[model samples]
Target: MSRLLVTGGAGFIGSNFVHHVMEHSDDEVVVLDKMTYAGNAASLEGLPESRFTFVRGDICDRELVDRLVSGVDAVVHFAAESHNDNSLANPEPFITTNLYGTFALLEAVRKHDVRYHHISTDEVYGDLELDDPEKFHETTPYKPSSPYSASKAGSDLLVRAWARSFGVRATLSNCSNNYGPRQHVEKFIPRQITNVIDGIRPKLYGQGLNVRDWIHVDDHNAAVLLILERGEIGQTYLIGANGEQDNKTVIEKILTLMGQPADAYDHVNDRPGHDMRYAIDASRLREELGWEPTYKDFDAGLAATVEWYRANEGWWRPQKAAVEAKYAAQGQ
Candidate 1:
C-alpha cells in the first residue's frame, strides 16, 4: 500500500480527498495541515487510526516538510490560501503560502526524490467573455487577475521548473470550481446554502451573471488519483464536469430545492475583478488518462450538497457567524 502525504488535508477539497482515499483504496494517508481558519480537524474525525495520521504544521517549514517527504511514497500538494476576497484584503499570506510554500515542498521532494502532484485552479487562465465560445485548455496562457490566482500561477511554474531542472517526478492538474461537504461557508455555494438554512436571504453578486464550471469534490479527487497512477511525468491535465451555471441559476436552484421561491434571493455588490465566465476543456484528460466525471448533473449534485449542509449544520455552524460578519464588514 502506498503512503501519501496530503497537504491541506483538513480543509475543504483536501478533506474530501482524504475521505475518498480512505474509503476507496488501501493506501494510507499522512495529512499535514496548519489548522488555518478554513482547516477543520473535525472534518477528518472518525477515520481508522491505523491508516490515518494528522500533523499540524506549516508547509513553508522546510525542515518539517523534508521529514514528512522522506517517508511518504508521494506528496499531494493541496495547501493554499484560497479565498479571493481575503487575498484582495491582504495579499501577503497568499504569496507566502501559495508561492513560497510550494517552493519548500518542491525542494523537499527534490531532495528525497518522491512522486509529487500539484493541485491548481483554472483562474490562472483568466476569464472568458460571456459571448465567447472558448473554454480553457492545457495551453491556455496565464493571465491571473487576482492576487490569489497570481500566486497559484507562480506556483504552477515552480512545479514545471523543478520537474525540468531537477528531474523531480511531478504532475499538475488545474480544476474548475468545486463544491461539496466540509467546505467553508465563505465560499459561494455553501454560503447560500447555509444562509437559507439560517432563515437569511441568499445574496447574489452583481446581477449574478458570472458563470463557473462546477465539479463535485469527489469527481475532482478521482481525477487527481487517476493522473497520479497513470499520467506521464511533467504532463498537465484539466479536470472539469461540463457543469456550467451562472450565479443566479445556482442560487435559484438552491432556493427551490429548499422549498422557497426561485426569486427569493437578493443581489449584493460584486467582488472586484470578478471573472465573467470560466469554462474548462477536459478533452486531454479524458483522451489521455481515460478520466470522466460521475456527477454529471449539476442540479442533482447541488441538491445533495444543500442537503449536506442542512443535515450537518453542527459542522458548518461554528464558522457561519464569523464568515457572514466578515462579508458584512466588506459590504459584500
Candidate 2:
C-alpha cells in the first residue's frame, strides 16, 4: 500500500516496473515522465488511470519534482537521457537530465524525507578487461568513458552524497543490458529484432566480440521492487540475470529463434571508444534481499520477445521506421 512515485515510468523498463507493481502489490503508483522519444505511452496501454496516475513532466523541474515527491512514500528515479549514440551526438541533455535531474530529486527527497531509489547502468564501471572481465561489485571504482556513463556516475555519487550529508534514504542499483518487449528500437536487441523482421540487416559493430550481461525487463523490475522494500539505505545493489553473451553470439541466438541465419546481417563499423564488456556481481542483491531472477536464461526470454515483435507489428512499425530513417539520414 505504498504510494510510489516512479520517474520515467513510460519507458520500457519503467513501464514494466509499473505493471509489475500493479500486478504484485496494491500500492498506488504515480508515473512522472517527460514522454521523450523513447518514452511511449503505448507501453502502458490498458493500465487503469484510477489506481495509476501519469504526469507529463521532466525530472529537472525542481518545483514539479518537489510537488510530486510530496505525500509519496518513496521515489524510484529512472528518468534520463539513455541512448549512448544520442549522447555522443549531444551530451547536453544527458548532463542536464541525468546529473541535474538526480540532484533535483535528491533535494526533493531531502526536503520531504522519503525513500529514494536511483536506477543506474553498469556502464558507470567502464569497460572490463578482456582477460578477466569479472563481475563488477558494488564498490567497483567508476571509470566512465562516454558522456552518458559519466553522467550516470555523477548522479550515483550525488545520491550517495545526499545519504551521507543529509541522511536521506537513498539506494542505488546498477544493472546490465535489459531486453524485452516494448524496448526502443535504438537499443541493440530490439534494433536487431526489428531489422531482421523488416528484411534489413542487423548491423554488427566491430567484430561483434563485445560482451554484456543480459537481464529481462521483468527481472529488473522485480529486483527494483525487492530493493525498494527490503534493501538497506545508503547502499548500492547490482542487478543482473547472470546471462552473459557477446554481440555476435546474441545476434546469432536471435536469428536462430527467428528461423534466420547469421548471414542475415552484415558487419558494421564499431562505434568509436565502445566499451568491450559490462558485467555485474549481483550476489549482494541475492544474499541481502533474496532477489534472484526467475528468468535466468535469456534464450527462452529472447525467443518470447522475438515472437512478441512478430505479432505486434502495428506497435513497432512506425517507431522502427523513424529510427531507421534517422540512421539512414546520418549515413550510418
**Which candidate wins on lDDT?**
1
Error of 1 at 293 (Å): 0.8
- Model 2 deviation from the true structure expressed as Cα RMSD, one decimal place: 1.0
lDDT of 1 at 326: 89
Local distance difference test values of all predictions, in order: 0.96, 0.91
Model 1, 59-133: lDDT tens per residue?
999999999999999999999999999999999999999999999999999999999999999999999998899
Worst 10 residues of 1 by lDDT: 323-332
Alpha-carbon runs more than 4 Å astray in model 1: none
The alpha-carbon RMSD values of the candidates against the true structure, listed in the order shown, are 0.6, 1.0
lDDT of 1 at 294: 88
Cα deviation of 197, candidate 2, in Å: 1.2
**Could you tell me the TM-score of candidate 1?**
0.99
- Global lDDT of model 2: 0.91
How close to the true structure is residue 26 of candidate 2, measured as C-alpha lDDT?
Answer: 92
- Report the lDDT tens digits of candidate 2 across residue range 160-221: 99999999999999999999988988889989998988878888887999999999999999
